[model samples]
Target: MEAPVSADKLRFLIYRFKERLWVKPLTFCLLSIAAVFFAKIIDGTPLAEHLPIIEQSSVETLLSIMASSMLVIATFSTGTMVNAYTSASNSSTPRSVSLIIADDVSQNALSTFVGAFIFSVVAITSLKNAFYGDAGVFMLFVLTCTVFAIVILTFIRWVDSIARLGRVGSTIQKVEDAAMKAIDHRLNNPRLGGFVQPNLTALKEQGAEPVYCEQTGYVQLVDMTKAQNWCEHHNACLHILVLPGDFVSPNNPVALIERTATNPTSNKASFESTEAAACEANDIIKVGHERSFEGDPRFGLIVLGEIAARALSPSVNDPGTAISIIGSYVRLFLCWAKKDEIRDKPTDEIVQFTRVSAPELNTKDMFNDAFSPIARDGANIIEVAIRMQKALQVIAKCENKDIQKYAQEQASIAYKKSMNTFQFEEDKGRLDETKWSD
Candidate 1:
């Protein structure tokens, strides 16, 4: 049992915060303000004497120019980003807009522009108010020049990146990357640091108490660490009923808790303990309005599937994009199969949370999420169907039994769909040639 999420809780929170459009820019703005004042510390230092004298007027003029130019650039960049976001939402699935918005280049470029503008304004104000002596002005001058070089380099890089930021190819790649990352994490921590859950019905029959969620939403992050702690505290075993990306309501139970046979508590005390522990167990599960990329590998696959469906829509009718998505699906599943092989081999896969039991992600469900929509939508297009079958053919060759099984299943579905939809015998015959082998 790898306690990845225990450390990841903080990392996950930080990742969520970084996803917001304002966070990086706000950070840069504060740093910019601090930089202006920081240079002031050099004013009375002996090192100030070694610093070449820079005229206050020259520095002031440069700051004024930078301030005005950066403001305009920032405004223009913002509008462009908005347009890119709109383009992404329209061309790709709207779910992918979050990934585009969280793009490092775009965010860094925008943050630099905003931060530079603030830096200029602050520096100019300080200069006008005589806040810097000769030494400070010299140091500020060097800082100003450095800012200029960074802004120019960023602007150039940003222009190149903005050109393709929301384009279909770029957006598809982003989605694929996100999906791969999520899939890799899940493969590494198969049961999310818990033992395989034996049987839910059997456990419940043995007097396990189901812990119901207070609200209705998708399960975003299941802090397995917290669940482990709860189990340790009560000397009980916890069975996680819901995996990340599972929809839950007050009617649905998030987990089940059963007292261990070794526990010394009597029946009366155990019942009371269950009642008191229910709320604590519930808090370990974090629910949200929409599905998140973290903790939910299926969400990424679902998003990719949605994109392929959108491309196959009559309005878009982009079979090429659909084919590309199928290729991405192949890469993701192949990577998954490779990781599955590694996980199966005996290694230091430590079981830290002995009291926690979590369900493994179903390969069938993952295949359904990744391929079903594309199979349905692309049934009529021989190119997409051929490519999809071929992709499945490759995946079905993997040694991992689950991967091979599901890939074959999806291939069968896609083949049947093509048989029904193809108007020409030649098209059907072409797809048949790419069918998965035993």
Candidate 2:
């Protein structure tokens, strides 16, 4: 499917681009090459003559140290990151690896480290060839000092970031950031900036024909532009039944189409054109079992659930992690609940003119997606249950009646679940009543 347009689309593209492990490193490498040449230009300038003096031997030694140490640092950083990813997958959830891998600080720190190494090697080569005079040599020494300082600072920060990179708390934070961004967008554009049409029953009564999915998997993205274009070209109205994060089955109806034919020949052409449009719409709707970072914010919620599930597993038995995940679930829900803007105004006339319809994502459905697994597995864990109850109670304060009711119901279920699991009244009593405190 063509990817969702506007803010969500741009955010998705930028995220994927920046998440690349090599992007910053490669960019730094190029900049290092530029800096080297830049230093050459500044070497013989009048400004270079007044630059602080430094010995040839000192620079040579510094270059050698940087060259050797950076290579080791590169290897070490790679190994550390690999280990972090492994640990996250084992202790937390594998789905979170993608978010952690995209950590901006970690990527930039690694990039600076690698870039410094390259700069040193090139600087050393320049020195060996006697490429600089006293001024150039002096400038190179200053640049090297700056590089050293950067290496030290970057190393310090990288150490701190890597320590928690794939840990449960960090993973939850990443998922929450992602989900909240999506939810906020959804809150503003409930129908995703498209038309607010009737349900499947209403559309079916209007003689709308169903468009079956070509493949079975999670609907990652829908190309609104392409789908709308297909409808416009065929003079049809397409009503979407599925959205991103929806699991589709092969030959299942994903959208229902209504043909608008005014001419008698157009009536016959309408059926044929509707079939063609359905095929094109299916092509426009990209589906796969693996959820993508683009289009859907719910994927992040699902991942947050994964973390809770893993934390509750017998091997991990980490209630704190589950609590953290539940907290993130609440944060995301609040963001979704309070959201009021679509985040991006439609850029094209077609989007505003088309009768294409997209459904609003329900908070209750996402609530279940993020918390049900933990509720199922960690019901017996007092801390997890209490935290979940409090989290829901906090959300209930939002004053949205339906959400409050849902929160109370989930809290009730949690209490009942704990009661069933606990043999002692003391354990059950601990959860029977939860104080509503921030």
Name the candidate that leads on lDDT.
1
Candidate 1, residue 190: the lDDT equals 77
Query: What TM-score, computed on C-alpha atoms, does each candidate reach?
Result: 0.95, 0.83
TM-score of 2: 0.83
Stretches off by above 4 angstroms in model 1 are 1-5, 262-273, 345-350
Per-residue lDDT of model 2, residues 17-69, tens digit only: 77689988999999887777677787657787677777989999998999999
Per-prediction CA RMSD (Å): 2.7, 4.5
Name the best candidate (by TM-score): 1
